[model samples]
Target: MSTLSGAPAPPRIPEAVHRRRWAILAVLMFGLLIVVLDNSILNVAVKTIASPEPTGIGATQSELEWAMNSYTLVFAGLLFTAGLFGDRIGRKKVLVFGVAVFGVGSALAAFSGSPGELIAYRAVMGFGGAFVMPATLAVVMDVFERHEQPRAIGIWAGSVGVGMAIGPITGGLLIEHFWWGSIFLINVPVVVVALIAMALLLPDSRDPNPGRMDPLGVMLSIIGLILLVYGIIRGGELANFSAPSVLLPMVGGLVVLVCFVLHEWRTDHPAIDITYFKRPAFAAAVTAIALVFFALTGVTFFSAFYLQSVRGYDALEAGLLILPLAVAQMVVALRARLIVDRFGARSVCTVGMLLVAMVLAAFVMFDVSTPLWVIELVLLMQGVAMALITPPVTVSVMQSLPREKAGSGSAVSNTFRQVGGALGIAVLGSLLSTQYRGAIEGHLSVVPSGARQAAGESIEATLAAAERLGPAGKALIGPANEAFLHAMHLTALVSTGVALIGALVVAVFLPDGDPEPERESAEGAPGRALPVSGR
Candidate 1:
């Protein structure tokens, strides 16, 4: 097949695996749950973590930003290589190992006594998560037949919404009644459950024959992503892209990535088949995923602060406020396929991204006096827009590849989504920080002279400083809230613009009809049950 067509034969799962696939999907979702849950839980707990000791580790805003970015940098860096591992070594083994490591990292993160320790531990969690995320989807690709893959993927994508719903509310409850560490600690039991179920139910599957591993290619990819992401984070930190420290790494990273791509294109047995990305639909699907998550995650990172710090909601209350967003995601995601079938991927995605842009702009109207129901309505709308965007685009990306290349497809999908999120947090979060600092600097006179600079860094810092001053400190609250609102408004506007950019990409590139898969007819070859169904 390689000498002639270069495409592999159709995939055939063991009948046992096929029979147990729905159950196996549940186990995979359990694995995905902890990964999604960790981030969503942090959304609500970040405010508490910024609080002074006894309740939290008293992490500064920058440290908190680092905490999130550290996890993302490592996760994005390793994802493609991890996918290659799944394809070559085994999906089930890699999934189990990843879940186990996630559990260990969770426990370590729960025990971290300082911001630095927590950041390090979170990176460890990312290492495990990098493996878990792609393998689960690859396994889904393995067990399900082509026609049924969309439904399976929809439900699978919807599970992320479920995790989003459960995480915030659960974190809210735990934070209200117990230590903040309890949020991370809760992941331990879920991990244990996922591991056991995986052991019992998951089938070990891999490319029975794979080409040579490209170690140099893997190293180059890791280095390139880390450098690029580091540059993005630094730019956001300083809010300036011209600084030598920022420009150097960013330029170096781009050159390295270009080299890596050229090498893979020329080399036999390249780490990822770079040619697949040359397909328009495949490229658009990846772009849409990356851009949407970029808009969504950046907003998500700051909304917690806006809800709690600016609007005076407690952790539990803020979590509850976010429920509508997740609920809409779950409901709409499950039904997105039917809509796409009628309207086609291009129409649905373009329209969805436009709706997302509108929803983000809707956030601009919210202020101190805005009613809670107004916020909830906008959140619900946001969820529906995202749901419409996620499933079709995901299906497009996965369906483009031959079944044998599912691991790489899944890797391409998740890797960009994570990188988008990483950039979103760094870029948008930095915008919020910078805007708040400028807005509040003149008013920091309410704080002691020594603490004025720190107090103006963020709304949380300003509030914390005010509290330290006792009665005199109470004066800082008004200005802090006002400053954050200004920043939040600007960030939301920018996110709306990003969503529009995504919409434009989808409209210009994705096919008006569903993109046909390359070779799915072989899946049902008369009565043939050949294990090697393809080339």
Candidate 2:
């Protein structure tokens, strides 16, 4: 492998780090578990949070969406900067600091009194997550030699699925037995354990020459994304995209993002290298990640409500229902790389996208009384589809980039994934709200005129109004369930379309084959080392 001219020598790995690589991997996974787990847990807990005061935060549908998007906005925006910090400061230091900050943020979020406060604290958690996520991958490269990285990366990526799948089940147990806040509170102890292990088992590694940090680019990206997502969420809340509030932010966000692109093109020290998108394979792979996550995360957001509110499952039961999804993702992700290694990314991912689209389309058939097994089967297949897509798409992205630019490749991949997810939740959540509000509006006449608008906001709102109406409110229950089912089906159908588009993109543009020579992988990438695989 060729080293860049005048690049400083790579950091030497300590004997102890090599000796305890697996344990070190455990430490890294612990860090990853809490970051991914927090979001998945909230998916289950969102219902409880939407319940009226005393039992829940009494949040509206838009507030609940903000609570999730806030974290993603901050996390996606700061990821590149955090990865750079890890290379400049030391992965161990950044990992430990990020864990501590995340712990404090989780503790704060657990006690939040309102949706607004929860969104704020969640952003703090995102700040910590940005640092922790990249550092962990960088450390994996530090500890493992090139020969073992592929396997190590495969396991690392698999754990991400495990974290995502297990969270709903874990949150179910907690939300059933304890307060809604306990879900967030649970992260504190895990963060403590991870911190202690890092202090002991984690090794320090840094780039001897981590060039020019890009604060301007990071700031612009963050500002632009937040503005754009805010506009989308606001449009949903009003059910009117033509409104000034929606158009203003959406246009402003677009303008800022354009400025960000221009700056990156002009600056010597850009956070993201836009030129990389010139590579057809890299462009297609990242777009697939963006679109797939956009579609899937949106459906996942609505599934929690469909399970608990429409189907009348308890939190625990809902969690158990999603267990098949978790199991499939965890089981299949571990094997996706080997499948890709033999079959190539283009075939596996394109087929995977089509499979994903088919499963999402199945959701169009769900109603208030859809069979439980059918729902489980859909989720199981959804997990398998995602597992097929993530690993190979990740490898293809890296394979297309110059070996020296792999750090940017990894950061850019994660940024797109997070941004895609945030948009999914915003766009899809808004669609559900708009459809439900329309469907339930006539039914809201059962309540006072003043309460009608509120009740029409969501099925939960309608049910809460019905609960206040006592026996008469019983009339709203059937209608509320029907309306919500209508909204969910429409949203799922839209997601299916998005997934199909991703399949077309992958089939047309993604490259074939595994990454280049082991030596040419992310191990020797400039700045902090990028993972050979992905999250």
Candidate 3:
């Protein structure tokens, strides 16, 4: 799938050798696993390392905020610009450069002297991740023709699910015996192997006419995304009605985003090429993917906290509790392409979203006293729902576009997902924080110290303090625990409602596969676009 200018068609590797295509796909999947794992590996380590060497020098709530958001904010901001650059240059070359940059960033993060240093390095790592992610998908589209693409992407997507599933467990194990920085160091060898494989297997690919890169558009995008993410993450920390810290970033980010849209409309070589949104299928597919991450990220964020904080589970035990979700996700991921091949993406995605909604609602009954089986069932259901949805929707978005624009198209789709993940954690986390704080304040109103805030800004603090409390304090903590769980229940309910809305949107706007004539010949099959056949 390399798109060299005036370059002759590459000699196809013989299928007898198992084809170079699958090998190339393996290299890309390595890249996908690295990027996806990086997103969640720190989840289990955050609680362990929030405190600095002096015990609490750099362990404030804001510091914890930087530790998590720094990576994602930069990753989302740079995604589109990196894709545009990769398409302009060669995707393979860009990926190599990205690997080198990420390696250096990882080393710095591993050896970081302070929390601030780690945040800076994390941002650098994210910049590199932006390049690797889009390039991987673009190469897949280039190497595998439309028909073979489903199977190829299915394998890649499944690996991603497995990597994400393992990330928390790996982090938990490493943190138990090692330091927080071990998570970053572990990426080094993986990157080295990935870089070598990529160099040997991936063919060069780039847009035929990439045109000029829009500097204005790039700046607008970065600033807008950063501000939006920061505001969302810092929600409720500002003044009640209209605080500048909150209002400025949220409103200003929106303005900058609108300006970016206008800039893309006017510019000849827009970074994102906003015209893609005109296609209903593309829009629906991206939305579905984003919505999935929105729910999944929120669940992961809160569930880890609930397991460790309320249930008093160690990191290993918490990770083990989450194993069912990952296992179910992998099982269902293997079947997605088969289901889509038989039924089509439209039906699979809609049903998948509804299933997620039902699963989330089922968890609303969870409490400090809820049985473990109840939690396991919810996790399993969510895993299966995600597994069924992610691959087909991603495949549809990539296949709908011409091969040349695959890099940009994949980046656009991924951007939605990253943004959704950030928003979900920020919004839902804020809701829980606000509710927890109010609950503690109300329950401890009689304390002579005027109800000092909980240590470490965690809901778990009240529950843990219960052990040392007098009879009166013990009574107070019981109400606080109830409030915290109540807030979590509300967050889950809101997420379910949003997911259902996304499902309805997909059903209304997205059409079934009706392969157009130009696409049919290019795809080299008739009615292959129709409802998928049997597995």
Candidate 4:
């Protein structure tokens, strides 16, 4: 094979990876797992962190909401900017830096002395997550060939379920044996390993000619998201959407978001391609993913409280009970690609959403008297439904875009999901609070005014107040539990409606078959100008 009068040519590096890709995927998944785990692990530990004791910080319900929302709010706000940043610079570099930053944030969060401090640290972690999240998916898209992409994405999506599964159980064990802070401290070692693996295994990726950063778009998105989320949180906490706290930010955020859309439409170099929404498949996929997260996050938020506060399960027991949901999601997610290939994304996603709607409706049956097995069964069904929907919807969105825009696409997808989650927690959490307070108000007449305000604040507070009252508190316990159950039923009904609406949207709009193959653009990057594919 040697050329005449010349030494043999250097060994060629293959353009496509066939074997090493899987190793790369493993590294990407580890990074994804930690980011996802941080989102849910705190859910199980909320009570422990809020307990007024030597180890607890005595956070109010509003403070607790801030603790969760701060992470998601900042995460959502920074995601698009981070994704663009990674694409312009280097995905692997940004990912590594993100992991390092996340590790530092985790270490600080573990030592937070107050809820406010924890919220600040969580926001820092979220900033790191914004960098890490999109890069992981973008790298997967870069490394894997088109044909193998579905399976790789399925596995990637399944890692989210794995994180969900591990978060609560890990948090529970750590909180039970050590302290609530240990849940965060555990991330440090994991991050160290992830950083080392990512550095060694991941190939660098970036858009060689990515346009200038869109500063206006970044500011608009960040301000819009934070304000909207803050307004929602305030509305829920105050139980008055008409109040200035709710109205001003909510309206202002909406206006700013509309302006952002306009700005993107007019800009030559936009952070996100505003025209992506013109594709029905892309739009439907985004909506489906967002709605699913909305339902899942809200339900998980209340379910944690219900399991521990209402049902009298300890943290470990509650975490174990929630384990079935994650288990079912992980198992089914592994098979989602096959199912989608056999059927279609449209069919699979539609069915999944309907299943989610059905599961939410089933939650109405849950109460203090409901059997543990029944609760587990319902959770399992919800997990299966999410498994079917999430992977297909995500893959569809990824497929709809050109590979060159993978970072931006991943950011948009994740931003919507995180925003939906934040809104879910805010809206549903508010509804629960309002209903619980209303229902429990009459029953709390016997209690002192000072104690009554504390009891009305949250289920956890009510339970804690009752414990202090001892015998008198025993009477308050039954009503408080009943109020919580009532609120759960209301929220479930609302969630059922939301899920069914998502199902309808997917069925009506999402295309029935594979996406059209993308062609290379004038600049040699893949472009999304191909005609839509049909079944």
Candidate 5:
């Protein structure tokens, strides 16, 4: 078969390996589980690892923030390039190598003696994750037939929610029985199992005619994403969106990203095909996925604190309470394809987004006196909404891409989702902080000036101040909790708007029905480029 550029096609997979596609999926899911787990597991472990007393690393608040944000920044920065590289090289090889690297990073992290060391080690884990994440989805797209891809993608999307739900619970359990390092140590064995299975069961696939590497594009993308993520993380931590620390990096990152797009559009060998965004299915699907994550991460961030701080639940209890959300997502995700088939992507995703918006609106009514059952019900509905949206959006995006560009497509989808989540945490957390500070300031006059500064800083600080002051401190607790709740309600209101806007975008832009699959070259060469369908 002759291509436009006349490059030789890549080698075909053996028919024998095709029979074990389901086994391949299991391996992929296991690898995916570990990567996704790391994103959330550390949240529950942070206090234990950062406390000044016994079994802690004596990390400062800033250091604790970095322990989480560093991983995310590095992961998002490297994802696109990693995916494109896997497409050019062998995806299976990259996946195995990534798991091995992640295991090594986890082992090193388990032995970290300081917060700085742990932060560095987490960055290593993020690097490994970038490699593993996109490769898993790309491999799934390769192994599954077009008709069966949606269900497979649904299961894949469900694994992400499952890992997220289980992370905090698993961390809470480990922290109770074992050392603080146990959380990181747990990943080693899991990664080992994933590595072994991946090696044995997965088939290697790559774009045979993949052109020259776009080093400039890679550099720009990495720099832009890192700067953008860094700014967001710093903004949330400092609670000052207008500060130079936040605006400079954020604006610089945005400018560089624009440059990256222009460069990609002009380059003969682009890392990401800019034309993919022109397809309504691809663009709308990515937007929907990003919006879902934006809501998910934002709500989860504050709600975890609300459960433990205001509601007086233990860490383990809080994790358990959130488990229903994960369970609901898994159940609904398994049936997402059927829903999409019956109602179409536009209707299903739009309804899902609106459902999430409605739940966020309900959360605006939350206060210190709100019942636990009400919160639980909201979480359950949010999970169902997420399940409905994520799988179909993912399936649509993957279905729209050519087989050879699957890695790039997966990376783009995942990157946008991660960035959206990061922005949600940053922007919403900042809003919560600002409102909490303003609401509680007037009430702090009863406390001494020396104590007032610490008291007004955060809900935790206020509670601690109240505890130290005895009855007077206790007096402050009620008002402080109320203030925090007010902030949470405001944040929820903002999130509701964001979700509704996402629904509007989907309703307006996304096309209904399953996209027609592009036919392969007549000679069955997988590397040849096919004409994409117009929106």
Candidate 6:
């Protein structure tokens, strides 16, 4: 039944097969959504976990940071290699395996007794996620027709918005009524349902002509991504000009990544198909996508904390406050196919990126003294921009590739986005922390020397205590809060710059046309024809 031969008879599309494909896509989407949502939910819970425990074991600031980073670090590191593996073996088999591993890891995270245990389990979950994410998109491409692809992709993209929307609200409610662990435990039931659906619906498909796995290339990618992310997060946290520990990994990671580029250039069939960059459309779309996530992920990570830490909202309240961003993203995603078909990727993405930048700039203006509605309005504007941007960008990338290589093509696109997100969190997060300290130090300088020492010694603790501070202490805290808000504003400004870069990149690079088909139609007709685009 190979579709490789140009004259191979057109395989009849059985009705049952089409039904099964749709069902499988739905199940996979559910599973993938749960994984995406978990990444964001923890942002709202960080402050809640850090309180009362001076040792910061269950919930310290460092522990909270690790809880989030541990997952992302592993996810980005393994994505490229894992995508190749899934294509070589079988997408369904790989996905089922990933879901099981993810479920077990989630359970382990929920029951983790210490910060170390939680970090370890989160890493395990990330490993499973690596396989799960690539396989889901690969299978979707395989099962759907080219005409059906955009609509399906639009739906797929919307899952992220759905996941993003649900994470905060559901996570918030669970934390409010239950313990922090409940957030992790919540994945189990959802995963179980998804597993059942996948088993029943997904087809078994493997690469018709697979290549050998590239071990050295895999190692280079993993090491390069890890060190790069480590340097950024560390630099953001410490922001020290003279620290060897921070500088070493950061510099070392960049060196390794440079070596990786050289290695890929020389290898036959490199683990990552770096040659995709040769296509202007592919290069431009990828750059725009990375920039897109750079802005949104930073906002998602920081704003969640801003609501919880600065505004003193509980988990649910913080989640509810960020809901607009998610809701707007969802509505935009569902309709993105129609929008892209009419306007082209360049126009849609350009407008979207510009809007996102504007919203981010508006956010930078917020202060402790600023009203809450203004923050919400800015967020709403950003939400609208993201809604338009993400779907078309993804559709553009997929359409630019040949169908036979759809799995790897989508994987490369996804890997870049994840890498950008990891960097955004690291870079922007560091900026916020650095600015926060500077603002805190500057404002506290106006305080008497004795009080300044206390503020300097334990900012997190003092901030916690300041909440209970009476009017006089509250007076002192007013400046501290303003400093914290100011730091966040600087972060917003950084995101605005990042988004602006993405808009220009998309405008310059992504091709203008009806989103080109990833699965190109067979050339000629009847007996004299090319094979169906996918093997």
Cα RMSD to the true fold for all candidates:
3.4, 3.8, 5.3, 5.0, 4.3, 3.8
Provide backbone clash counts, one per model.
Answer: 3, 0, 2, 0, 1, 3
Question: What residue pairs clash in candidate 4, if any at all?
Answer: none
Given candidate 3, what's the lDDT at residue 318? 77
Kindly provide the TM-score of model 4 when superposed on the true structure, using C-alpha atoms. 0.94
List per-prediction Cα lDDT, in the order shown.
Answer: 0.87, 0.81, 0.73, 0.84, 0.83, 0.74
* TM per prediction: 0.95, 0.91, 0.88, 0.94, 0.92, 0.90
Candidate 4 at 62: error in angstroms?
1.5
Q: Candidate 5, TM-score vs. the true structure?
A: 0.92
Better of 2 and 4 by lDDT: 4
Predicted candidate 4: what Cα RMSD to the true structure?
5.0
Which portions of model 4 miss their true places by more than 4 Å?
1-18, 523-535
Query: Pick by TM-score: which candidate is best?
Result: 1
Find the 10 residues in a row with the least total lDDT in model 5.
526-535
Among the numbered candidates, top lDDT falls to: 1
Write the residue-wise lDDT of candidate 2 on 346-455 in tens digits. 99999999999999999989987788889899999988998899877776665555433444556677878887887788788888888888888887777999889888
What does candidate 6 score on TM?
0.90
Model 6 clash pairs?
A: 49-59, 50-59, 236-430
Off by over 4 Å in 1: 1-11, 519-535
Prediction 1 TM-score vs. true? 0.95
Ordering by TM-score: 1, 4, 5, 2, 6, 3
Q: Where does the lowest 10-residue lDDT sum fall in candidate 2? A: 526-535
Q: How well does candidate 1 score on lDDT at residue 226?
A: 85
Choose 4 or 6, whichever is better by lDDT: 4
lDDT value, candidate 4, whole model? 0.84
Put down candidate 4 lDDT per residue, 1-535, tens digits, no spaces: 2334365532221344434788889999999998878766888888888798566788888888888887887788888888888777878888998889999999999999888899999989988988999999988877776778889999998998899899888888888999778989999999999998887777777776677778999899889877887787778778678999899999999999999999999999897889899888789999988888787678888888888888888777787888989999998998999999999989999999999999999989988889989999999998899999988888888888877677888988998898888778888888888998898888887678977887788888888888888887889888999999999999999998989889999999999888755545653334422111110
